[model samples]
Target: MKALPITVIRSIELLGLVLLITVLYVGSSIIMPVLLSFFISIMLLPVYRFFRKRKIPEIMSIILPILLLALFLAVLVWFFSSQISVLISEFDQIKKNVGMHLEKLSKWIESSFNYSATEQTKFINEQSNNILNSLGNILGGAMGSFSNFIIFFGLLPIYIFLMLFYKNLFLKFIFTWFRKEDHEKVKEGLKESEEIIKSYLLGLLIQITYMTILLGGLLLILGIKHALLIGVIFAILNLIPYIGALFGNIIGVLLTLSSSQELSSVFTVLIVIAIVQFLDNNILMPRIVGSKVKINAFAAIIGVVIGGSVAGISGMFLALPMIAVFKIIFDRTETLKHWGVLLADERPKDGENMI
Candidate 1:
């Protein structure tokens, strides 16, 4: 065989890596929902335990949780459907008032920068309609793909059922994989992982509730129309992490300015969103999530981004918790301790914070 050049060999290696990544991405798409279903089952563990402690059979305990989960999902769907119908009904009104909203924004920018209203208008008005139209088209196409969505949604029950049924089997598999000498470490790691995920979910749920109520009240006080609807929407979105709050803030401020065309309302809404985020980041996250799932903000953001990119919204929700689980396992393994430290919250050694 002829000798290959080093550069050509390296190029081939890089190509192989790219191909591997592509395959991995495709696999992740199929596995994402399964992982999501499992995570959900994990979340229900507490409730399952609660009922079990009350002398309920394991099977019956699962029944209440399954029912409760269904009810919760149903209510969420109803709320979103109702709100969306209202928004769609008002679309013509919103479109008609776009110019007024843009004008208000232009004036504010112009005033702040000491520029002409016309100049400001030019900056804000450049293809804003075109962008909105493009977004509408994309969203409409996604909405039309109901069959595709249905396939994924229908898979949920199967995934959920399997997880619930084989929960103990799953645990046993982990334990059995370890050497007898390292079994203690495995148990400790699992315990830590459980606590971390529990705290993270609890904290996030509590924070989201606060965001809904606080933002809704702020919007109401600011005289924004459909404050409750927007508030609820933002709150749900806020669960997705960094990008969610930013998107929510933009929508909230735009809608506020659109209705009132008041610079003060825009500023007020922005301030309210900022404060809510501050509380979520500082007070709520640290206290609620605690040091349970230790992870740096950058790593956390990357995890969410990867999750979002992989399985979209569903991926986004599962990404962080999944990362936390990996971190927990890493923390317990001697070889992986350094990597775990990298994933951990970059705080003091004496004590750490979650937020």
Candidate 2:
């Protein structure tokens, strides 16, 4: 039999890729949790191995890591909740400040547009009523989704445990997909992918810690209210790459405006955040995350957007590591190396990491 033409094969590959993406998007509710669990399991592998090394029981090894993860999340939630409660207690003040700002904004709009205050009030009332109607529907939808969130959270640990327990089975499943001669390459790809995932996740945790400290501490010193809350929110949002940092800036500015009487506080917050982001991007992130993932800015941004479209915020956070893993596998396979090249940044300079 004659072999297929290269163009035909390429076309087929593209078709398959599109189909796979469609399936993933359509089944994201099921797939996203599985993917999240896989990543979490991989991150916890080291802890699991450490316990296993000490001849600990397999169940204990699994439970320990999950317990630690739960404790960390609990503390984080408690801290943020406490800050949020403080903010909530100041809701009346925030509302007053917001009303004052809105009135000023309304006056400016009225002057510029020659719109009467009565007309503006009518428009505002109509819009507010529409928004309230939508809000009820949104709340109803949210209530439905809250159960899904509970299921996802509850299943995550169980999935992690199963994945860890059946690690050898997954390895066998991967190996069985390739020819015997290609097993070595597959093994190498798996190792590289695991290292990249572990490194990337750990680096993010470090980034969050330092960013919270630096941003929150700086804001506090600068006399910004809800400094820690702003820092924590920004740091978490910063996980989404370029788009996330922009949103973080917007959120920080809004928080500043709500709590601050001085307009200059907005500028101060923005400038401080810019400096902190610069230091992180230029100095801190490079040292921490390094070039282990090897993804370009364009690819990273595209990944975030695609991920967000497919799986919301969870997808955004998972996108980078997922792409990195794909790149690793693609680069290792000769037929797919071009795809890997497309995903990667320009080659790093000799002995230098390009993050």
TM-score of each: 0.79, 0.95
| Candidate whose lDDT is highest | 2
* Model 2 misplaced stretches (Cα beyond 4 Å): 347-355
CA lDDT of every candidate:
0.77, 0.92
Q: For all the candidates, what are their Cα RMSDs to the real structure?
A: 6.3, 3.4
What tens-digit string does per-residue lDDT give for candidate 1 at 1-355?
Answer: 9989968865885697478546647887568768777777777889988999999987888878877888988987898799778778888777757777766657887788889987765765777777886997888888866765787778877788678878889989988888899888888888777777777776776776777788888778877777876787788888887888878887787676555545677787778778877877788777777777666889989888877776778778877888899888777877456657778886655656532
Question: Global CA lDDT of candidate 2, please?
Answer: 0.92
Worst 10 residues of 1 by lDDT: 346-355
